[model samples]
Each structure stands twice: as C-alpha cells, then as structure tokens.
Target: MKAKIKATWVSVFLLIAIEQTIKIIIYNNFFDKRFAILPPILYFEPMFNRHYSWFNSMLKLNAGKGLHIAVVVILSILVIVFYRFLTKRIGSIKIVNIMFAFLFSGAMCSLIDKVFWDGSLDYIMLKGFFTFDLKDLYIDVFIGLMILLLFTKNEQLKQIDEKVLLKDFLDCLLNKKHY
Candidate 1:
C-alpha cells in the first residue's frame, strides 16, 4: 500500500471512531426520544423513517436500530469493492482512496444515528430555515468537496496528458518521418 493509501485508511478509521462516539453519547444520554438539545434553529431528537426506496415511497424496509448494522455491513462491502475497482484502474487509486475515506466517514456518521435512534434521525427543524443533522451535513459537504477536487484535478491531469502526447508525437515525427 502506498503512503497516501495508508493515510486515507487512517483517516477513515478516525472518522468512524468519532462518529461512533457521537452516536453512543446521544444514545446513552438522550435515548428518551425527545429533543434533548435545541438551539434556535436546530433540535436533537430521535426519529424513525421506515420508508426505504428513494423518496421514501416504495419498499417498506425498516430503518431501525438493527438497520444500522445492515447499513454498516452493506456499505463496508461496497467500500471494499469500490476500492478494489479503483486499484485496478492503474493511475487513479489516489483519487479513489480519498473518495472512499470521505464516504466511509459519512457512512459511520449516519450509521450511528440509525443504530441509536432505532431509525434514521430527523431532528432538525426550523421555522423558516433548512434543517439538517450533523451526519447529513457532513456527508453533503464531503460530496461537494469531492466534486470540486475532481474537476480541478481533472483539468490538471488533462494538461499533463496533452503535454506527454505532444512530446511523443514530436519525437516520432523527428525520428521517422516515413508518413
């Protein structure tokens, strides 16, 4: 494994631990299913969103405490497979590692909420503002960052590839102008 890969793995683990700690704290302290913490715009409460399929309309899969374990299992498998696929791509492993790290962290965060709350936690509510929990917000930010990074790095990678191709073309023409 490369150093960058090792670093990414470490980051994933750390993030997971942090997420779990937060979950446990919430579970132990406020498992009463009430909004324990409330700032003017936010509230910490337990919830249950059982609807499964996207938009929560179809597939009545339960999103309870046990569902958290299921999510962890499925997501872990996905991350491993995704990481392996990236490794096979030769030069794109670093990007994959970073993305995986972000995804892993987000998964851990949401998993905690599900496990402790017996379902997906949806405590956020505001009179006139958007509401989101810590886990959801973190995941969104991670995805946003990943997209930005991809676009920026893609431009640089394209430039590098072009330079290399131009050099190779010039070398071929100079050495053998048979065409």
Candidate 2:
C-alpha cells in the first residue's frame, strides 16, 4: 500500500510537470500562432480558455474570477472525497490507481492555470471545431479508462476482494496471465 501510494504520487507529479512544461513552451513560442500539422485535420493553435469545460460559456454564466475560484475549490474537494471513497472500496487496482493519478494531475494543471494565468493554454486544434491541451487529454483518457473499468467483467478484477499489499498488486500487474 505504501509503495502504491508512493508510485501514484510520483506519477501524478511527473504528469503535472510535463503538462505544465509543454503549456509554458506553447505559451511562449506559439501564442496567437497557428501551424498546420496535417493541414485541416490537426493544427497547433494556441488559445486561452477561462471557463470550466465550456459549461460557463454554454450557459452564459459570465462568472467572475472569485466565483470561478470558489466553485472550482468546492468541486475539487468533492472530487477528492469521491476518489478516496472509490479507492477504499475497490482496493488498489493498477488501472484505477493510474486513472486517479491522471485525473488528479489534470485537475491540478487546470487549477494552476486558474491561479497563475487565469486560463489554460490550449494548443491542439482538431478540425477547427475545438482546441485542447495535454491536461484535457489527460482528463479525457482518465474518463475513458474509468468507463472501461466500470464495464469490464474480468474475473481477476472481481477477485480483488480486499485491500491488496503493494507488492502483490505490482506482481499481479506484471503477471498478465492473471488477467
């Protein structure tokens, strides 16, 4: 358990570091610039978004900075609580743990943007329909993995009846036949 917790923290930190580094590079070098990367399908266009998942824009909330910070803090607390609950109930499954790390890291990236930049730097444009960043990718991947885990009916997953020791969990992850 200790080892798992350590590994999760390391993963989270590394992800956040990489995401922020990329964001900084894009902000400095590519702000207001667009480059065709596979023209018409994908492009590197930097954009700044202050809203939370387009919810504020879709609803035309026009939320103030204070309100945005307050809402994010409340939601972040709730997410942490939910994450803890899930971890307690599901033991230390590797995929689930990795998903949590990604989720947390993505949230942290956005939070850092809100605090420092007032918005996140989105550079990956898809079909000119939408723009996103690495943080968004992390969150999207986490959600997809979470849905897969929820729908999967593997016996090994069901056999995780109690909290697993870190060594056993790592061993199981390395031993693919167990799946």
Candidate 3:
C-alpha cells in the first residue's frame, strides 16, 4: 500500500512536470502558433488564462492571483481530507490513489500556475467552446473515474459521511486534529 501511494505521487509529479514542460516550451516558442490536430474542430493554440478556469472566466470572476491561490488551497485541503477518509475506510487502494492523484495534481498545478505563471497557459483549443491545457485533462480524469467509481464502488463510497468529512477538514484547518 505504501508503495502504491508512493507510486501515485511519483506518477502525479511526473505528469505535472511533463505537462508544465510542454506548456512552457510551447508558450516560449509558439505562443501564437496554432497547429490543427483536427482542423476546424480541435487545435493546439496557446492561451494565457488570467482566471483559474473557463468556468471562472465565463462567470467573469476576474479574481486576483491571491484569491485564486486561496481557493486552490482550500480545494486542496478538502481533497486531502476526503483522501484520508478513503484511505482509512478502504486502505490504500491503487485505483483510489490514482483517482485522488488526478485531483491533487490538478489542484497543485493550478496553484503553481497562480503563483508562478500569473495564470494557466492553456494550449488545447476546442472550437466554439473553450481552450484548456494538460492540467485540465488531469482534472477530467478524476471526474470521469469518480463517476465510474460511484457505480462500481458504490458500496464503499456509500460509507462516506459528508458531515464527518467536513468536520475533519475544519478540524485540520483549525489545528484541532491531525490528518
């Protein structure tokens, strides 16, 4: 289990490093260049997102980097609490670790983007919709797997106590409990 957890972290950091490296390379060398993978549908076009996500931009959040980082931190806290809950309930299952890793990596990448990049450097464009980057793909994996788990691991997930999870998170934030 420990090995699995270690592998999860290693995989996540590798994904982050690779994704960010690609983003940085493209941003540096081809910021305005667009290469069509599927012309008129999908393309790799760089975009600098000052907001955290497309949802935030669409809603016109326009929040400062400080606020963005704060939100990411809070999200990360929630993710950790939930992950700890799962580990306690089901042990360190690899699939669960991978699932949480996706969420964790996405949050960490977003936090990094806020602190260092001023915003996310999105390069994947979906015509008539929005542009996203690799971090977005990481988040997407979590969402997809979570939905699948909701049905497949329904019994285990049903053991989740929302109230307890919330309390645990609050306790951690208040330094009243150690996670």
Q: How high is each candidate's TM-score?
A: 0.56, 0.79, 0.85
lDDT by residue (tens digit), candidate 3, 1-179: 77887888898898889888987899789997978989889999898988776667999977777877888899898788777766765678766898888889988998888888988999989999999998999999999998888678556557868788677767766889775
Cα lDDT tens digits, model 1, 3-105, are: 7777887988887776566656655776566552456555555444434212333344444446557867697676665465445433445655767777777
Better of 2 and 3 by TM-score: 3
TM-score of 1: 0.56
lDDT for each of the candidates? Answer: 0.58, 0.76, 0.83
Question: Which residue pairs clash in candidate 3?
Answer: none
Candidate 2 structure quality by residue, lDDT tens digits, 1-179: 66886798899999999999988887787787788988869998888887755567568888776777676677666566555555654556688779888888888887787888887778888984788889989899999997898789866566655455444444544673232
Better of 1 and 3 by TM-score: 3
TM-score of 3: 0.85
Q: Which of 1 and 2 is the better model by lDDT?
A: 2
